[model samples]
Target: MAREQFDLIVFDWDGTLMDSTAHITRSIQAACQDLGLPVPADQAASYVIGLGLREALQMAAPTLDPADYPRLIERYRFHYFLKDQATELFAGVREMLQALRDDGYLLAVATGKSRVGLNRALDQTSLTSLFDGTRCADETFSKPHPAMLHELTRELGQGLARTVMIGDTTHDLQMARNAGTAAIGVTYGAHAASSLEALQPEFVAQNVAELSAWLREHA
Candidate 1:
């Protein structure tokens, strides 16, 4: 049987669309310092990609008292949002998104960022208008859960079989699988190529140019 073409494309925000790992790591470290918790460095931060702030805080500061999770999340969000609002879009992202939008493909974001955080980044990068819709951590369940993708498709009045998820993490791939949508993993993000490949996405692209070409062929 032939594969169904995708009408909608859902994106993962941080590591996939934006090159804000350095800023994120620094913010996480600062948050930890403020909370008097152990700070995770760059490599450690990568492991937290695709996770909500509450989850990332647990991984980055495992020894913290369980009762402090909420406070930790608040502090992390406060620091990261203030600094990362100025984050840059990944190379070719704006052009690729414009092309997709111009082509009449539905574009949306399904990210681990809070709604406020996603809005801030989108506004800062001038990408707020590019997306037709968005589902953030604060708005839906975090990745590896499929709730965000499912909700996005429903909101767009699209079918899961006709949607594609574009992300850089296994969490995104797994979410796609759970939601019965196709997935494309990007290499130029937080997760390594091999790591993303391990999830067996329907496609994998090394960069935005490559991703755009693949989408042109597939979508």
Candidate 2:
């Protein structure tokens, strides 16, 4: 058996587990079109995938006024839900998570999603009970802030040395670094593997299968 290097494994929700990046990007574009704002490019839209909705909207559509945020959010949500019904979890994600859980590792989620949005996504899959705890951007500080990781570790009673974050975006890696924990980057998500490499994650998995193999050995 491999030695246990970590006891708490924190994951990111959208791009990390669920393959919802393209849907989210398109939804953001649709919302911009609905409001007659110039649509952001796909890269611009995807770059904000791990941020709070309002922050993401502002970054993607910088021409919009703050007062227009409410309507923008509503339209974005409308468009997202329209396509979200078709989005699915990445292949082998559930099985990998279950394997880690079976190995006695506590799993948790730290995401930029709101509590409501995260719960809705989880309710759609068999992953509702897989996470031991969760922290949301809406309920706590947003990514790159470290608050989410801090809260998750505190709640789990897990020390920083025994905790590791798994995510697809630089924000996720930065959050883990800020919280003084290790991180593993996944390439099959929003950010490019090269970009994630700058953050110096302990490992970079190209897909769920690779991620699972790394975790089996290290976590």
Residues 1-219 of candidate 2 have per-residue lDDT tens digits of 454799899999989999998999999999999999999999888999898888889999999989999999999999998877699999999999898888788899998888999999999887889899999999988888989888888898999888999999998999899999999999988899998999999999999999999888777
Q: Candidate 2, which ten residues in sequence have the lowest lDDT sum?
A: 1-10
What TM-score does structure 2 among the candidates reach?
0.97
Give candidate 1 misplaced runs (Cα > 4 Å): 1-4
Best by lDDT: 2
How much lDDT does each candidate structure score?
0.84, 0.91
- Each candidate: how many clashes? 0, 0
**What are the per-residue Cα lDDT tens digits for candidate 1 across 1-219?**
123498888999987889986777777788888988877877787768788778777888899999988888778778877866477888888898998888888899998888877877887888888898899887767778989988889888999889999998888888999989999999877778898898889888988889988887777
Residue 82 displacement (Å), model 1 = 4.9
